[model samples]
Target chain A: MNNKLKQLDEQAVQYIAVGAAVLGTGGGGDPHIGKLMALEAIRKYGPVRVLSPEELADDDLVIPLSMIGAPTVMNEKIPSVQQMAMPLDLIEKELGRKVTAIMPIEVGGGNSLVPVLAAAERGIPILDADAMGRAFPESQMVTFYLDGIDCSPITMADERGNGVLMHAIDGIWEERMARAITIQMGGSASICDYPVSGAQAKQSAIPHTLSLAYDIGKTLFESKDSKQNPIEALLEQLHGYALFQGKAVDIRRRTEGGFTKGEAVFEGTDAYRDRMMRLFFQNEFLLATEEGKSLAVTPDLISLLDQDTGMPITTENLKYGARVVAVGFPCDPKWRAPKGLDTVGPQYFGYDVPYVPIEELAGGKGEKL
Target chain B: MNNKLKQLDEQAVQYIAVGAAVLGTGGGGDPHIGKLMALEAIRKYGPVRVLSPEELADDDLVIPLSMIGAPTVMNEKIPSVQQMAMPLDLIEKELGRKVTAIMPIEVGGGNSLVPVLAAAERGIPILDADAMGRAFPESQMVTFYLDGIDCSPITMADERGNGVLMHAIDGIWEERMARAITIQMGGSASICDYPVSGAQAKQSAIPHTLSLAYDIGKTLFESKDSKQNPIEALLEQLHGYALFQGKAVDIRRRTEGGFTKGEAVFEGTDAYRDRMMRLFFQNEFLLATEEGKSLAVTPDLISLLDQDTGMPITTENLKYGARVVAVGFPCDPKWRAPKGLDTVGPQYFGYDVPYVPIEELAGGKGEKL
Candidate 1:
């Protein structure tokens, strides 16, 4: 690998981690491992430039890449190095084409780094954004779905060297078939699919997501260095607001139909004193409600982080006695569209509240103190 | 409408019901309403021919159509006529292409008839097959997944005239996005997508599933009509075997994230007297086990029907007094492949049982006196 590219790769790890942390908006899982993976890939293969979708040709072949399975499993069974590359390689061979770029399906947790690593190892460029600006539990929650993109010719490779490829007639079949395989493959697999023209990619992807992730991560890190308020810094960076801060006191978890579903009960602390907050989590943090009233639901970002360190917390990693700050960020304007509301709103998560934009829910100040 | 075709449509409802019942294996929900919908559509439009995939050219477009939402809601709310046609029509305009054929993503429950109705109403031909020969709770379970088809570009429409179309970059995203939409659309919606060419459709689809369903359904009806053994006739027709026969003594249910998940405790009645068989349901029958050992899991058609009328009983509709018989049928041989197994076997549902083919599990001998 070129020495300069290697150095740049090292730089990207820090930048990406910072940016990913900020973009995570307090919900993407901690980026430590993701940063390491991307760093290693970049160091080994050479620096992969993060390009805007506009930079690519309209017909440039691109695939959104991510890992599909339980986040809880991901921590335990960390994927083999080749598992991620195998799916992309298979897709390339199957189509008899070369992928021009790699994109992340979502901006949260391990997904933020998956594409960067893929791009570096394959010596391809990374798109500077993701389909979903935040995290979601399933495969079809991206902007591509709203744009009518087909997620076919997807290759899912498990650690056992068993690979299953699904060429479903629609995206839903892809989820069902892939999920079945995922559960069978020991609940984790690497996926690469949703080929699109660069033009479509540009229109559908959240622009500059990588830079944003790096910037956010950097802000958190710098805040610590300068002895500033890290949480406040994050809010200012994303123009986000503090939703709540509390101490988790109870957790009830159960695996149902292969999905991790549970809730974390919290006793208010600091700003949330004398109040209780219950946060529900599946693959991503879904709902944060006080008493019986709704505070926040999915499609918008909801995150839990240590108050002091501003470090991220995975949903599965949450526990009692942990103090966290819940933060909220506005989603892509596209996600706020009627179609978007229909796809990812409070009502969709079984809450009866009408689609209240974060701006309105946050009291129109755009940031709660 | 084709008057000659209308006559066939009228006659086919009974056959379609039988086909739906058999294909549902036991969990397609009461086919009575679905049968009525198909009959009405057939009358209004024309007879829907179930054509084999081989009949089409490589360029012929095929779309897999179905409903996505809580099955219980479908049973109670029932979909308005237009909801079924809206999504496909909207998507057709978006793609600016004529849809050549419609197929079922899953062949069990209400999904089977929704597509037939759409095809008849749209005056399009219906493919004589489906992606999954049986039903699965989620949209992503299908043979198309094995062949690398994606579930994105899915068009979902509610009875309220609202529609959402997604183009996720992956299959799982499709589920996440569509599910939220389904929830927003009032707990249920009509869906039509997974368009494909006839060549790909043929290669990936379970061929002649409609005919198979019709045959099995006919045998069951005839058996019931003649006061013969309806269960025996179904077993013979499907080459399946009885799993257990019992009376439902207890049912625990809760609606979570839009799916009806719970347990049904059945007390053995006939040969299984005094023995307890537990059935699990999520919109469709997912698993059945005795004493904690899973006997059958999803993607392998599992259905529990009324011992008398042979009508299907939905998971949500299970009462404490219903007498039911559970049957296990061999899935399409295609589902037996590694890709197929990975896509729909017991392991896919998080059960640890290595697949014991239903035929073998039944020991080549079905329920008999």
Candidate 2:
């Protein structure tokens, strides 16, 4: 391995870890585990290049890689390494072709690292981005999906040498089939699917995710020693805005059929005390409401941070009486369109708020609705 | 419409309706509405030829289609006509190829008709087969899945003019994402997914499903008129042996997100009288046991039938004091394979039974294990 390449790999990991933490907002599970996994893969595979969408050839085939199941179960049941490549191998056999690149399905927690590690170990290149700019709970919640991409020739495997391949007519069937197998596989399985042509990959995946992740991660870590406002630093980097400042007052959680669903009630802290906010979660934070009015919905980033440390908190880890700050970041421009709003907007989540641009929702700038 | 086609459609519908009833046994939502939908589609689209597995080309592209959501909601919501084709359209657009054939994902209740109707409407040919000879909840419970296939390029669509295309890293992500989107899309959505190759389809899908459904439906309908035992008639048609006979004494249910999860306590009737059997259901009857020993698990058919009408009872429609016959049918031989069993058999659903072939479990000379 080239020494410079190894150095870049280490530096990239630090950035990804920070960016993943920032992008995770207040949920998407802890980034520590995913960071470690990616780091380990890098150590084993040497340096991985951070490719831009523009770097892809039109005929190149790319697969989106991820871990699907209850995050709670993920903690309890570690995945079998074989399961990780099951989808990739199955698809290759099915297509009778080789995969050219690996892409993360999302840029949050374990997902962000899953593809990176998988690519590194396989000695494959990784598309420096993901489908969703932030995390959402479902497979269909991706830009590629909105762009009408197919997820078939998808494969799922378990550690016990058990595997299932399904060429779903659509993305929904993939979800239905995979969920059953994951539960059977003890609630967590490694997956790599969604073979896409390089053209589709360039058009659909969020662009330049690697560079953004690295920048965000580097800022967060470096700022920690400098006593910088990591959250604010993140906001500037992503051009996001703070949506609320509060303290978690109540949390209710229930795991059903291998999914964790619940809500977090927060009492506003500064400039917002006496007002109440509720954040709902299902593996990922989905909705946020303040004073009984909808504030933010998915497709937009909703990050919850510790008031003091500026550290992010995950949905499962939210505790009562913890001071927190809620921030809203704008998603890719493509997501704000009619189709996008209908998909990840507030209305989609059973809320009535016409999606207010994050710039408008943020305080101090007087960005109007 | 061709007069001959109408008659064939009617006959097919009649057979499918009856087969849906028995195949549903205990938990595939009421197939009536879907039956109507399929009938309408078949009537409009002309007769759908049910091709046997051997008829498919080695290179043909085959896909299975279905609607996934609460049967209760399907009853009221009445899926939009467009939702069925959205995912198919999405996948086709992504693949940049035409699909050669369509197949049923599960040959039970409404789902059985889903692919037939989708094929009729799309004017594509449908294989006379399915992945699971019967129904099981979740997407990963198919023969193809057991064979380590991928479920990606899967598409999910909602009636609210919103559609998501997901190509997740695995089947589990596909399920998780689809479930969340389904809930968000009014607790249910019409889905068309599961794409497979004809060669794999021939090997994976249960063969002769069309004939099986027709025979089962015809037998059940004829038995209603002839005063013969409908359950026995169904068993004979399926070459299936009886598992148990019982009367439901209690049912507990509540809808979470969109799925209806519940339990039914059965007081054995006729030969099974005085012996208690319990069934756990979530959209479909998933597990059953007698005297604390597990009887049937997923990837295998577990059905509850109305003792009088031979009509299948869905978990959402189960009521106390209903006399029902519970039966287990021989699954496709492929499912009996160790790999298939590991992917879907009793053990996959958390049961400890060493996959006693249903033929053996039925203790009969018919349909040898």
**Candidate number achieving the greatest TM-score relative to the actual structure:** 2
Per-model CA lDDT versus the true structure: 0.71, 0.71
Tens digit of per-residue lDDT, candidate 2, span B1-369: 111121237678767766765676454446776688778887788877666678788888887777777776777877645777876776676567888887778877677777766677877777777777777767776777777777867776676555555555566656665676577576777665568887888777777766667777777778889967887777666666555677878888877756777788999767676899888777777677788765665555777778887777777777888887777766667777777776666666565666665555545553211
Question: Over all chains combined, what TM-score does candidate 1 have?
Answer: 0.54
- Residue-wise lDDT of candidate 2 within A1-369, one digit each (tens)? 011212237667766765775686544445777777777777777877656678789999888878887777776655534567776776676678998888888877667777766677678888876888887766677888788888776776666655555555666666765675577667777775578999999888887666676677777777788866777776667777676788887899887666778888988767887888889878777778877665666777788877766666777677889898887777788788888887777777666667776665554352211
lDDT of 1 by residue, A233-270 (tens): 88877777688888889988765533567788888887
Lowest lDDT 10-residue stretch of candidate 1 chain A: A1-10
Model 1 lDDT tens row, B1-369: 011222226556676565675566445545777877887887787788766777889989888877777766777777756877787875685567989988877776466777877787767887777887877766666777667776556677777565555454456556665675566556777776577777888788887767666666666667776967787767766676688888999998877766766778899997888799888777667678899876666656787777886666667667898998888777777778887777667676666667767666566776662
Kept native contacts, as fractions per model, are 0.00, 0.00
* Residue A316 error, candidate 1, Å: 20
Instruction: Supply the TM-score of chain A against the true chain A for every candidate structure.
Output: 0.92, 0.90
